[model samples]
Target: TEGLVMAKNSSAADQLELIALAVRGNVSLALAARAVRSAVEAGEYEAIARALADQAGRNDPLQPRDRALAATVAAELSRLGSKAAPLWQVAREAWELERSAWWLAYALFREAEALLSAAGKRDAARDVLVRARSIARLLEAAPLLAEIDALAGRGRVDLGSPSPQLLDPVPDRKLPISDREMEVLVLIAKGLTNKEIASELFISERTAAHHVGHIFDKLGVSNRVEAASVAHQAGVLVEDT
Candidate 1:
């Protein structure tokens, strides 16, 4: 449906209204999924997360792609501290429903990401990344391959090679902060609060907080002072532009 496009620049209330209407009217599952995505992209977390979990968990049939997408979104929201659904259960269900599909690979990538972030789950994440890598190569999907490889490097997962050349992830960077995280780190070094960081970077405050959490984890710090000290020592704390 054209509802997603129409909701693109819409207010939060309008987007939520359209989604509620779609759900109540029994619109196409795919259309409702698109509406959910649009709302998520606009940073509507609480209501969107609740609605997504309800639809995805309902007994209705879901297409393979939509199933994986729902899982992916749920996992990301879970990472941001939403109480919608458990990440492991959601991710596993998405792949179990459609093994050996491109969408499964994407969901697995997200699963690996969520696992990698959790304590004591690096081994599981590595295993999931290996599976995702195999599918990416099978599909000859250069982009997905690159994404998985980069993630593997960051997570320090040594995905064993078939022919060795098939898994050429870039070497783990000495400093593992991503480009966007680098931007956030710089802002953090300047003592910006999460809301201030969001305003400066044009991202949702929730996303800004997520980035800060990742930054702290990657830098092995609990607070901004420690994070900034580590960055300065690592020479990643150049003057903020």
Candidate 2:
């Protein structure tokens, strides 16, 4: 217990030290923003937000980019609380700050999905799915396109009528990537991080990063949560990690 406490304290100190270094301009604000975004993408949203808040609390005049990042993080926190209107608005504002096309496509897809579902509009959902399919195809993201196709195929479409299928159990063999990519997808669906994937695959972290990049491109997702959702829809999620 004593050793564990010391370790925890050391970890906290390290984080604080890193934050201080960042504030002192020892690192680019973009690097700090990337770290925060990575934390959020890894589903560590609270940590990301808290870190941002801590930096902001230091009463420093953050670079314009960092200020924008802070605003985005605040918006994400609001979104987590189920405020639909504000959430969507903030999501768009934040989307403009990043240059990653994959990220923007993923965000737009999310917005379309939200709009479709929120208005009880199944027909619109189908349309959005079709558009998402087109975008994924244009990006040469075949695996993601297949996943979208599967979604479109799973439900009946008749004048916005709704008969939702059981999403947790579907055909697992319909994965759209190569076998190796599928293996990574299954692990991702099981909620494994890239580090964990590297350890499991006995590969270097760089190799694992490469696989994850390919998976995201092929899967048409910019983050793991979306990939996991699609995997669940396709019945790729297994009982264990």
Provide TM-scores for the models. Answer: 0.49, 0.33
1-241: candidate 2 lDDT, tens digit per residue: 2233334456787756655655564344456688877876887665665555455334453544454456456445544533333333344445456444444444444444444435365656566555555567688876665545544433333223332222333444676676556667777777788887764443556777888889899878999888888777776554631
Candidate RMSDs in Å, in order, are 12.6, 18.3
lDDT of 1 by residue, 1-241 (tens): 3455556678999987766654543465666578778877887765565566566666654555455566666666665554423554576676677674776677678778766656577788888889888888899998888888867755557898532221223364366778778768767877889998775554668989999999999878999998877666666554422
Give residue 201's lDDT in candidate 2 (0 to 100): 45
Residue runs of model 1 more than 4 Å from their true location after superposition: 1-25, 28-47, 61-66, 79-85, 88-92, 162-241
* Candidate 1 local distance difference test against the native: 0.68
lDDT of each: 0.68, 0.55
Best candidate (score: TM-score): 1
Q: Could you tell me which 10 consecutive residues in candidate 2 have the lowest summed lDDT?
A: 157-166
Please give the range of 10 consecutive residues that has the lowest summed lDDT in model 1.
Answer: 161-170
Q: Which residue pairs of candidate 2 clash? A: none
Best by lDDT: 1
